[model samples]
Every structure is written in structure tokens, then in C-alpha cells.
Target: MPAYSDAPLPVGLDALVGMGMNRVKLAIAVALAEHGGCLSTPELIAALGEGVAGTTIARNLNELEDHGYVTGDVPRDERRRRRTHWTLNHANLHADLRALIQATTPSGEPPTVTG
Candidate 1:
């Protein structure tokens, strides 16, 4: 895939606060959005940073999956070892964010800022 920007999601971070999402979880989301809307555990770790432990990413990913934000599969590699390939559930994500925006806005209009 090609390189993509992650700007749209950072804008939703503040909105997600009402729903109890933290920056780390949102970071993982943004990274996945940037990476062609899909990335495995190792890919997410690399995109996040080497300093971030793999287990942490895995744990967060599992949580995201459970929360209906992301979904993926553990496919076996050529060596018969399993590896994860995560794909963003964009439909779910967009709908959730849209609901957030509509909830916070008047008449369900998205809030506009002059800055």
C-alpha cells in the first residue's frame, strides 16, 4: 500500500475522551489508519516505536478488537508460524466518531472551529 496521513483521527481524540479512550489506544488507531488501514502486531510496534514493548501493543490491539475498533486474523507464515494482520473496521470507527460529533453538536451538526 501507499503512505497515508493520520490527521483525521487526532481530531477525534478529544471527542473520544467522552467514551474513555486514551492516547495510547488512539495512537494505535492513528498508526493503523496511516498504514493503509491495516498492520500486524510487529508492524504496529515498529510504527509506534521500538521503545514500546510488543506485548503492550498486543494487549492494546486485543482490547481494540474486543471494543469493536479493529479486527484481524492470525495466519500462518511460510514456516507454519502464526502472525497477525490487523485491519481497521473503518465503518464502525467512522460511525462511532460521527455519533460522537453529532452528540456534542447542536441539531446534530458537526462543530466548526475558526482556527
Candidate 2:
């Protein structure tokens, strides 16, 4: 399990800048958000459907954690050798996205890209 910063943000915004808003990272974020925060690598792969390798899932999880969008905890099962569990940091996700958009847009101007 990995650790992440304690923060609040939306999943979409986090995925956007956290992983450069790439498709795979966005998918991972959606999976966690849809599941209400908390999913193992295998679970994410399963949710993403087949063809997603373990390494790919691992990479995405790590990336999310690095960006403070997700946090990991020890597995409840003691029998499980590898401690693996993750929770979404909604605060960070929302904050990051807001910051990203604000930083990119001019002051007092409507977001041209959105409308």
C-alpha cells in the first residue's frame, strides 16, 4: 500500500492534471470515484475490463498516489502477503482541477473551452 497527501478535489479534475488527463488515468479515476473510493489494482483491472495488465494498473495507481488523488492502506486480511487497498482523496482531486483550470484561464473570462 502507498500513501498520499490529505486533500479534497473532484475526481475528474484530479485525473485531468494528475495524469495529464490521459485516457487510462481518467479511466482509473472514474473507477475509484464510481466505486466510492477504494479499489485494489486487480479490482481496477477488472473494472477496466480485460487486456489491462497488472503492471499497467500498478503504474496508474502509483501515478494517482503521487499526485495526491489516492491513498493506500494495509489490507484487512492478514493472510494476504502484499498489503493492497486504496482510497480516493476527493479533496485533492477537486482542488487540483480547480487550480489547473484557474491557472490556465484568464481572469474574469468565461472558460472558452467549456461553453
Candidate 3:
């Protein structure tokens, strides 16, 4: 098992927000979450739609990986060329989303019913 930072999830969420992710990143995150944390680049692109380029996908994946949101490894065949496989870190994923949503709402206020 991989080691995870136990610091408040909000920190990580804030980090992601600071990184300036757009719809592409969100889609990648959702796809990784839905798959229970593992998918190929080609698979992700196919799942997301045709307009996404391989280089763009690679870049986003690298960003997510750098942020500790995903993990990947390269496997080589007889020619020694490498292929990478990515796995989402759900622990981080859900925690980050929860924290982000919580941060967006007004603080010190409870929801009131208006029936």
C-alpha cells in the first residue's frame, strides 16, 4: 500500500485549486474515481471523448500524478519501450472534493428550512 499524508484534506484541495485545473482535469478525476483508480491513457481519452489529444491527456495525468492524486508505473516489453498505467488515489480524491465543497459554502451558518 502507498503511504498517504494524513494532513487535512482541505490542504490538498486547496493545492489543486491553486494549480488551476479546468474541465479536462475534472473529467480525468471523475473517470479515475469511477473506475476505482486505474486506467490507461488511451482508455481515459476514449472515455472522455475524441477532442482530447494524447499529449494533453498525458500532461493532465502528469499533473494529477504530481499532486499525489494518482499513481503510475511504466512497464517495458522485449524492446524496452515503456507503457504507463495509472491508478487513482481515491482516498485523496474524495477527501479533496469534500473539502473543496465545504470550503465554498458560507461558514458558521446552518441550513434553514423554509416550508
Candidate 4:
């Protein structure tokens, strides 16, 4: 994958899901990236703004962490309860983003010059 600009660009649904990232994971990844690459579980949920259940978000976060797309742990929260803090793996994210952009591009033969 090629290097892209710092800003997070638009990613097509087909392209995103086609790269082995499920809907929830894709949404989470994008949200994390937009949030400067670090966000707690609750922050991530609010970032997504999809109204998905916390359990669902946790499940997707676990899967994303396992895939090296994100990294963090269930550390003690403000009240001393364990909570997940996820951070996007920028390297993997950039690579996946490049692939996603490539997937959305229309590929075909070059136009012929008749002039």
C-alpha cells in the first residue's frame, strides 16, 4: 500500500468490508483514526454515533485488537473498574486505508489517443 496524506479520506463500504474488516470494526477503525488514534471504549462508542450496544462495540474492539488494527487493555477506570482503552495502530491503518482507496478506484485500460 502507498503512503497517503495525514487526513482520513472517505472509504467505500464494499472496499472496507472486502478487506476482511467487518462493519463494526470498520466503523470503529475510522472513528479511532478520526479521534487522533486514541480513544477509550466509551469515547469510541460516542465517536461512532451509531447507537450500537456497548457489548457489540467491545466485541469489535477485541477483534480489531487481535488483528493488530488497534492496541490497548482493560485497565482500571476512574471508579476502579476495568475498561478498554483502544489506540489505532497507525502503520496498519495507513496500509489498510491505501488498499481501501485502491479498491474503490475504477480500473480499466488507458484511453487511446486518436489525434
Candidate 5:
């Protein structure tokens, strides 16, 4: 059988996944993008379901935040244990991110590559 593209993800995304962009991180970003680009930790946990632990999500969120891929917003009056809303960094990556997200979806097809 001829070799076929499995998911049709763009080259950049493939490279990103190869470069240690774990599934949870990608899922978080995709979830945020799909849901108005912002969500609290609890909302994310709910969206991601129970397979992933809450602590794991929190740690990955921090890692994403540290990498400038996402940001956590804490309200001034919020309590210590309250949730911090995470917002995907769109200032410099909105279009690129949307394109990547679209390309990685189930129905997304990769563009023909020519050299």
C-alpha cells in the first residue's frame, strides 16, 4: 500500500508536536480557541473531561503560560483559591494559531506540498 498522510496536519504542526508539544497542551489550546479564547481552570477541566487529572491540567497550564502561548488572568478581588482565567495569546499568533487549529481538526486536509 502507498504511504498516506494520517491526519493531514501542517508541517509546522507536525514539527511542533515533534518538538515536545504534548497532547494536553495542544488540547488546551484548541479548547481555548474553540471557546472564545478564554476559560477558567474548572471550565477547562470540564471541557477536557476526567481522563486527565486536575493537577496535570494546572501544571500544563502553567507551562503554557510560561511559554507565552497562554496567559492566566487573576482578578484583583478574587479569592486566593479562585480560578484564574486563561486566555490564548492572540496578539501575535491569532491567525497562525487559528490556521494550525483548523488544520489539525478531523476534517482538515493538508495542502499539496511542492518543491
Candidate 6:
């Protein structure tokens, strides 16, 4: 996947804030949706940029998980780093969420891999 850009989210973060949505959570969802696979906390932090504190992202990820918007897993092997890998939960309101994201984006499409 392409590196997450420092570019503001498609609708602009401020716009999302005005919409009364949790920006970090939505951003996390967007990142996971774009990745099309699991993303570790570190990867998410990097993707989201240095401006957002890791603690803040971690907290938001837990909230997203609790809300069933995302799921997280930890590697079982002792050799591997015990990082939680997160993925968007397609079983939930995925389409609606995607539509919400797409509506804010200029392309009117869910985030693409090429981005």
C-alpha cells in the first residue's frame, strides 16, 4: 500500500470535525479501509502522521474495536513483537461508513490503494 500522506483527509479534517464525527476514529477507519489488510498500531501512527499522539490513536483504536467498526489481533508467537494488528470490520456498517467517507472525498469513492 502507498504511504499515508500528510495531506488532510479528503474532506479536510476540520470539515469532519464540523460533521460531529470523531476525526481520529474516522481517520483510522479510512487508513484500515485503504490498507485492505491489518495495520499495527505503529504503522497506523506513522500513517496518521506525527501530529497525533500514539496514545490518542491507541485509545481511538480501542474505541473503534468496542464499537465493532474494527477488530484487533495480537500475534501468538513469542518471537514476534506483540503488536495489535487492526482491520476494518466488514461485518458491521461497512457500506454506510464507506459511503460516509466517499461522500467527503473529491473522487466520490472509498479510499483507493493508489492513493
* RMSD after CA superposition, every candidate: 10.9, 7.9, 8.4, 11.5, 9.5, 11.4
Rank candidates by lDDT, best first.
5, 2, 1, 3, 4, 6
Q: Put down candidate 2 lDDT per residue, 9-90, tens digits, no spaces.
A: 5444555555656677778888998997888766878889886777777777778777887887863334256747788887
- How would you encode candidate 4's per-residue C-alpha lDDT over 8-59 as one tens digit per residue? 5465333333335577887887888888988988898888776788879877
Candidate 1 has what TM-score? 0.67
- Computed on alpha carbons, the lDDT of every model, listed in order, comes to 0.70, 0.72, 0.69, 0.68, 0.72, 0.67
Q: Candidate 6, which segments miss by more than 4 Å at Cα?
A: 1-20, 75-81, 95-115
Model 3, residue 34: C-alpha shift (Å): 2.9
Q: List, residue by residue over 56-75, the lDDT tens digit for candidate 6.
A: 98778766666666777853
lDDT measured at residue 93 in model 4 versus the true structure, 0 to 100: 60
Q: Write the per-residue lDDT of candidate 5 for residues 5-99, one digit (tens) a residue.
A: 56766654543432146888888888999999999999999999999998888888777765567778974346269878999885534444455
Residue-pair clashes, model 1: 0
Q: Give the TM-score of candidate 2.
A: 0.68
Taking the candidates one at a time, how many backbone clashes does each contain?
0, 13, 1, 0, 0, 0
Ranking by TM-score: 2, 1, 3, 5, 4, 6
Best by TM-score: 2
Candidate 5, position 4, lDDT: 60
Runs of candidate 1 exceeding 4 Å displacement? 1-19, 75-81, 107-115
Give lDDT for model 5: 0.72
Better of 2 and 3 by lDDT: 2
Alpha-carbon runs more than 4 Å astray in model 2: 1-18, 75-83, 110-115
Candidate 4 steric clashes: 0
Over the full model, what C-alpha lDDT does candidate 6 score relative to the true structure?
0.67
Candidate 1: lDDT of 83? 71
Give, for candidate 2, the lowest lDDT window spanning 10 residues.
74-83
Pull out the clashing pairs in model 4: none
Residue pairs with colliding backbones in model 1 are none
